[model samples]
Target: MNEFRIIEDLHRLQNQFASLWDPFVAAGGSVYPALNIHKGSDQVTITALVSGIDPDSLDITVSGNQLRLSGEVISGAPKSDLGANRVERFHGKFQRSLELPAEVDPEKTTAEFKNGILHLTLPIRESVKPRKIQVQSK
Candidate 1:
């Protein structure tokens, strides 16, 4: 009935379409990295599994409520190595973008890479945080 509801419906339809095609396309490899996102009262945390990728190769950007992550993975196999029969590792460029449910403070965001995992902490905007207001009794 409203513009926001219409837009939300369209987004839901888009996700459903993507889900239907995911099984077919995922066999080749995922376009985006595996991710875990958690929202708390004061912050949002995102963790991505990116094994075998150098931290320096990653590019992270946050614009408003959107967060974008991109990077490349390079194989370390020797040039003179014998031919391999099976290869399941992922290489080359990959990127993923996500929209947050709440606004975040980009200036306070922090990222850390350790043990092949990228961890990001985004602080929620002060204006959007919930506050309890006391009612006055006359």
Candidate 2:
């Protein structure tokens, strides 16, 4: 019974160690075009790493508080006879949708791609902006 307990504890310890590397590889196997977003009082800024993809192939859409990103990544296969033995890079059509913290104006939103990074600036809707009310005394 003592040996079984010891084995279980070891297994738990191994799992903890494995989780330490989770941040780097956790969503790596599945999620593509990872995003980083920043929200301010008047706007929201989003950044996504999209290396090795053509700018013309990307499509971005925004509706209310929802933002959609769709694109395709083409693989650069080698022409050598040896061919590829190990392939790890992601390639294909991928779409990711994110909900914004505040409603945004899609008409005013701007997208820029430079150095393999897609940067978006979405202005918060005028209706959603906070306004101050004046107080009256009798």
Candidate 3:
């Protein structure tokens, strides 16, 4: 009856809706994920939420202005002797890409994955950075 419960219920409903549509996706086995991108003073950081995906299966590539994330996700079999009738996790091969707002040094990009999240840091090109200008009196 509370607001939190209502939110939780809505999330569950969304999950259910996703679950229903996922079978079709599974058959095709291709996905494009929406990623969250952030920028700092000298670096651009991207965090992608990719649960149930194997770290070894992921491939990342950065081109002139684009960053790509591609991977295959396989579902784990149930461990118990009792059969599981429901599966809610999303599975399949996914390839997601994001175009950087500004040019980044592709060679300096670093990637790390932990706790089902993929983190990427791309450093900005020094040439594009701002330098403090000094005013001279005439």
Candidate 4:
């Protein structure tokens, strides 16, 4: 029905307005791209929330025990909004490096960026993995 379509359109517009009003700083607006580093028995997994970034612009690298990620948010506006008065998406180069919690096998490190998210995996150095020790019940 026309009434139903009108309601749906209004809802969509309302959602867009809400997103526009929200402060970018309230979001992860940091140059670091906000990451979660997790350490496992054999690997370290790092996830970076790099939304609104161009996949082609991102660079992920691991050297020694350090992980470096850098990228830029290219200036882009919604097609329909090309004539609109204002825009909020960020633009510019951002860089951040993290000192890995422990030594990692640099050769085994790999990373992928999909839908504005970056996933990095680094294998733990063989010498750093915890070793099980036999204990005599004394």
Per candidate, the number of residue pairs that clash is: 0, 0, 0, 0
lDDT of 1 by residue, 1-138 (tens): 345445545554544455446442356434446677899999999998899999999999997789988888886656654564444455657666668777999999999999999999999999999999999999
Highest TM-score against the true fold, candidate: 2
Q: What's model 3's TM-score?
A: 0.65
lDDT at position 48, candidate 4: 87
Cα lDDT tens digits, model 4, 1-138, are 345445545554543454344343356243346678898888999988888887878887787788777778765655562353533344456666668888898888888888888888999999978899999897
lDDT of 3 by residue, 2-72 (tens): 45445545554554455446442455533344366887779888887787787889999987667778887
The digit string of per-residue lDDT tens for model 2 on 8-113 reads 4565454345444535236542346767889999999999989889999999999999998889988776667563555555566767776788999999999999
Cα misplacement distance, residue 102 of candidate 2 (Å)? 1.0
Deviation from native of the Cα of residue 77 in model 2, angstroms:
2.6
RMSD of 1: 11.8
Residue 33's lDDT in candidate 4: 63
Clashing residue pairs, candidate 4? none
Question: In model 2, what is the error at residue 48, expressed in angstroms?
Answer: 0.6
Error of 1 at 37 (Å): 0.6
TM-score per prediction, in order, is 0.73, 0.75, 0.65, 0.63
How far out, in Å, is residue 70 in model 2? 0.2
- lDDT against the true structure, per candidate, is 0.76, 0.78, 0.69, 0.70
